[model samples]
Target: MPTLAINNFNIFCATLGGFITLFGLVSYLFKEKYYLSEALISLIAGLIFSPHATNWIRPQEYALNDIEILDTITLYFTRLVLGVQLVLAGVQLPSKYLKKEWKSLSFLIGPGMTTMWIVTSLLVFALVPHISFLHALAVGACVTPTDPVLSNSIVKGKFADKNIPKELQKIIIAESGTNDGLGYPFLFLPLYLIQHIGHQGQGSDNSTRVAMGLWFGEMWAYTILLSIVYGAAVGWVAKKLLHWAEERKYVDRESFLVFAITLALFIVGTVGMIGSDDVLACFIAGNTFTWDDWFRLETMDDSFQPTIDMLLNVSVFIWFGAVAPWWLFAHSPVIPIWRLIVLGILVLLLRRLPIIFALHKKIHQIEEARQAVFVGFFGPIGVSAIFYLYVSHEFLNGITVDGEIREDAAYLKEVMEVVIWFLVICSVIVHGLCIPMAKLGFFIPRTLTTALDSLGRTGSDSSDDPQPAFQQAQAGESETTDAEDRLRRRPGWSRTGGDSLPTRVFRIGRSLMRSGTSSADANRAPGQAPLPVSSVPTIIDSGDGDGEGDASAKVDGKSDGSEVSTGGGGAAPSAPALGEDVISGRTIRFHDEQQQQRTEEAKVGQKV
Candidate 1:
């Protein structure tokens, strides 16, 4: 008796139709900070509708052949989408941008990512009973690789700037983008161990150590080394081939460029099927194709890649909903839903957040702690996690154990399915709500509470407070006016403050004058005294030893911190002898009464 069978065609149509409908709704009614977006709506609809349509959780048993075929098809779709993402992420970003954010990049890929994996795994082991450490860690590792497909909604300036630091979007985008490709080894290694660890000796007397050596030499090497070499070679060949075709005028339509991307992805995936790492190869090709000597390689348009990416992404989610034992998890006597929610909270609050904060020494681009916290919250374990979970279940599907995750593939499958589905579902809702909350400024009061009451601090607001202009610019938008560039160009801050700009001057910190160009009324924080509409001549830092602000900002009666007035005549303020910046907040400028009087006296003396 087959448990569930929707046939491949129906699965495809449902995902495609649902995706179209969801996007249509989002486009029509959900543009504002007020409404729910396509991603959330699609997920909810799929959870509610896909399963019943497919007979997913009924007593009928699926044929082994049908199940395996469906699994293989979905697996390919995952690879295709992942391949496109790798190419899009790698080719689009300049090497210089990576260099600029290397410190953040280091932490994101290394400690920050790893620690989250470890912490979340430990929490799962503790909370989710009947799961072995290896399986738990595998789940943890899967979740650690974030998809963040819809993350742009909040990070690209949708959140009210008060709760979210939009600048952190660069880190989030780059981190999520790179890690999804890089996480293959971590995800697969444990599953390999769990499936083959104790059984290796049946073929030959293979001990754990021997098995590990073979696994490392084979899987790891293919993943790290061969994959890179093959991908780069493929990239080179494709580039030349496209150039030749273009020269011969065979390639005329821009839509044909989709083939260029899809072809490369297909080649990479084929190599993986032959035992190389699909992800690493695609990622390498993505980067390699974008290099200088590519002769204007055929590239997919940014808009097209996402649309293509969404089709597969939604298919996986909808398919998961259709096949997964949603009824069992909700009604099953094995694990209560309340306990599952508690575990989710524990991992999210304890495991997810603290690691980000602890890694702050490296991720300096986050100017405010609240920003780092917001990024932490929106770190949704999305499509890639689902892909890895499917792979894990395939490997661990039939195995059973007496100690923890018992025999009975159905039970084990249900457990893994429940945990993953629950986490992702919760993430979708929590992450979805946060965007609107940010837009509505719900976090502003929370920000005050965290800043003053929790931290036990008080401050007056100055122009140094958070600036909307400092937030990251949208694609194709001009970045020349952004504070990101301003901070990065400064030398010392590159290693420390993370695209550092002296942002706010609270009451206790320093009195900051309004940017000469900004409207005073709009910049003020709630519960803070209004800044005078009379604009102070803002010292725009032309930056790096160009003493320009010195000449322009010095009002005759006002004191530039490093200047003084003589009684008889105004003497020029001596330029700071060192090119080294004082490593202070953008220093506030004000005139003392004594300096004002001396300037007046000097003026009188000059008149005489």
Candidate 2:
């Protein structure tokens, strides 16, 4: 067997490396400040250096002028990228997150995904002339699943950490990762419809029922169900083996770092060879592999997987940009340029936003209108769409002879590829620029305010009141809502520096407790000066106070350098601190003194 020449290998590597090196210096600013993404950057590079522009890198020519070779490359390339990214998503999610957020995930992957498929099909049918409804459905199915690759741009960066809620980010990650594989059913349904009825002249209603049954058995049962079982089993076995090995000092850190990527590709290959849902299996396997949290914790701080994931993403986008059918956009005999633009715009706008927005109240993760809008708008059509495009092509290619599609299926193939690719390009651009555009007020759904208090500002009405401004703190029972509790309970939660919600509230409560004036000070005249900081009594309320503000101490007196009566209860041991994120009621005497001094100065100024 002969292989293609590596004539442009050095050029390709040098070009890509140079582009990556330049982008690396400013990537932080792009992600953290400007809100741009590698997808957009690499895409622009592909376009600028593509055959259509500089003709610097031509993949089509490399395939020896055979489009099937290029299409095959694309199909497997996307499969690998999607598989690895899905597994990474599975690993990074908090433990038992799927079980906890099952309700919201069901709504998103079920109704949310179906709505996108149907609406997109309708748009394709309406915009493109001479296209059958079934063919249009094929195109819609291609774009139905959100691209996990593109979504990482918005959901996993510093911009997201500061501006987006963690729950919302997790929802997007889970939804995108799961639905990409689930889209097989949607894509194959239309293809089966076209194949059984339109292509072969099996016009009977009974045959349609049979085709549906085949889809259920093959696509759903074999592909989905079996893939999940297989993936979970593999993950469990791998996890146990790794644990057993590490306990005996057999496994090293390097092997652990590569485990996720290795598992992802292994599942993708073995599962694909068995004709099951490879991408879904990859995610399921990853989730189960990290279910016990040992592997994730051990490798939590390693940048190996993330760095590799970035490299995969950058390469694919660049390849996609280079191989994109620019000629078809202007020269397609079936669909006009104006119609394609309209389809792209409409698909991007209507694909997921309205359906998700309508069902926001039902999704526990989506608590605010802004969150709903963000989730809805950020479902980008990217690598997964490209992957499905070729899958549709191969399915339609079955009826072709000598590289020419039969007349009946040729137009379907043309419309599907053209429309799908156009949407992908538009989605990559629109969704990639979403954050920066939102920042500039050119887009809706502006960034959310950071949940953590930045400047130590507590939830208090006025400092001059001098009563215990507890700010909704409760003893024993927590004041945090279910959503907040979920966030606080997430693994790897930081307990210091007011970053996490519970820590901020804890700090606020402790600070207020120490600086609070006594009941005698509260009864002073409106313009009367208050006592100095040294005279104030520090009476700590345990938040189990009656209507008269009476309570006991809960904090361990040994840790805080202060003691209060425990009433009838014994002092409890302090909670064990993880790493440096210890949550303690340690006294900041200088801070308390400065706060009291400011209060006294305020009262003195009021007296004058």
Q: Which structure among the candidates has the greatest lDDT?
A: 2
Quality of model 2 by C-alpha lDDT: 0.76
Off by over 4 Å in 1: 1-22, 25-28, 53-69, 96-103, 152-167, 196-206, 243-250, 293-302, 313-315, 397-412, 441-608
> What's the true lDDT of residue 232 in model 1?
77
lDDT of 2 at 372: 86
For candidate 1, the lDDT comes to 0.57
Which residue pairs overlap in candidate 2's backbone?
Answer: none
Please state the error at residue 60 of candidate 2 in Å: 1.3
**What overall lDDT goes with each candidate model?**
0.57, 0.76
lDDT of 2 by residue, 1-608 (tens): 99866567766877789888888878766765678888988888998878989877789877888999999988999999998999998888888777888898999988999999999999999999987888888889999999989989878766776678888888888898889889899999987777666554533233677778879988889988998899999989988988888889997878878988999989989998988889889888888888877777877777798899899989999898899988999999889999999988888889899999999999988898988888888899999999888988887878554566666677888887788889999998988887787678842322222233311233544444232212333333313333444555668655232344555455444445543435335444458897653344433333222112222221222123233333335432332211112225633333223333334333432222
Q: In model 2, how large is the Cα lDDT of residue 197?
A: 69
Which 10-residue window of candidate 1 scores lowest in summed lDDT? 505-514
- TM-scores of the models, in the order given: 0.62, 0.72
Give the root-mean-square deviation of each candidate in angstroms. 16.4, 13.7
